[model samples]
Target: MLAALWAAEGPLGAAAVQSALGGRLARTTVTTILTRLHDKGAVSRSRVGRGFAYSPLQDSAGLTARRMRNELDKQHDRGTALARFVSQLTREDEELLRNLLGGAGDGVRGGPQPGVGDGPRP
Candidate 1:
């Protein structure tokens, strides 16, 4: 459902979403699902005639990152979990992360440093 909405050029009515899904789901089902998504903050809706048109609040990548943070928040041993996560990364991914944490190609010579204000802000 979200994929249908994401692929849309703009907000989509439930009927449009249902049609985009090849009519596999009923319009009522699409409306119900869009309502649920709006309640979950995953989508936003605006009045469209008697019904509503929905748009995804986050893109696919943003949604994935949100899910990752949610999963990490559930872990009691977050440090250990994060360490394990980093340990399992491929060399390319590890280097990419290192570059993201530091500056590009700076390498990991220095340990954790104080905030340089380059990371995402609340």
Candidate 2:
């Protein structure tokens, strides 16, 4: 449902969401999901005539940050949680991330080397 709402590019009505879901979901189910998402602070809603329109409370980036923070807070060890995250990255992702943090060609000054690249300096 969130994905449907996301693809709509803005607030969506219940019928639009149902149509986006291929009509597999009942309106009540979608409404329940929307209500739950709203309670989770993941969606915002407003009354539009007889029904409500729903939209993401935050963009993708904001949602990701909030979810990441929530996951980290749930862990007993912050360091372990971070290490597990780092371990899950593919080598290419690791390299690109390294470059971003290291400020290699990103225009920022030196921070920390990614310890992965020897590419020609930009």
Candidate 3:
């Protein structure tokens, strides 16, 4: 049900979601899921005539990033949190992270890279 909502290009009605789910889910079930997602800040809804059209607050990539940040914030130790994250990462992800952290072949050496700023706010 959530998959169908996520796959939709824009806000969708319950009927549209049911159709996308190939009638596997009841409209009431989809409504419940949408309500839950809305409470989680993952989805949003707007009035459309007498009913409503539901849509994601963020795209998949943005939602993933938000969830990752939320999970990291729940960890007691920042280092342990990061370590656990790195441990789960694939080789390509590890390499990319290393490069971003000033590993070999990374162009930025002493300070923040261009367009990436660090300092007190104005």
Cα RMSD to the true fold for all candidates? 8.8, 6.5, 9.8
- Candidate 2 structure quality by residue, lDDT tens digits, 49-81: 999999987767678878999999999999999
lDDT of each: 0.83, 0.82, 0.76
lDDT of candidate model 1 versus the reference: 0.83
Query: How big is the positional error of residue 37 in model 3, measured in Å on the Cα after superposition?
Result: 0.7
Evaluation by TM-score, superior candidate among 1 and 3: 1
Question: How many clashes show up per model?
Answer: 0, 0, 0
Q: What ranges in model 2 sit over 4 Å off? A: 103-122
User: Please, what's the RMSD in Å of model 1?
Assistant: 8.8
True lDDT of residue 31, candidate 3: 79
- Identify the candidate with maximal TM-score: 1
Candidate rank order under TM-score? 1, 2, 3
Q: Largest lDDT belongs to which candidate?
A: 1
48-99: candidate 3 lDDT, tens digit per residue: 9887899888767688788888988988898988988888776655555566
Relative to the unseen true structure, what is the C-alpha lDDT of residue 113 in candidate 1, on a scale of 0 to 100? 38
The deviation in Å at residue 107 for candidate 3 is 14
- Superposition error at 57 for model 3 (Å): 1.7
Model 1, stretches more than 4 Å misplaced?
Answer: 104-122
Spell out the clash pairs found in candidate 1.
Answer: none
| Worst-scoring 10-residue span by lDDT in model 1 | 113-122
Query: RMSD (Cα, Å) of candidate 3?
Result: 9.8
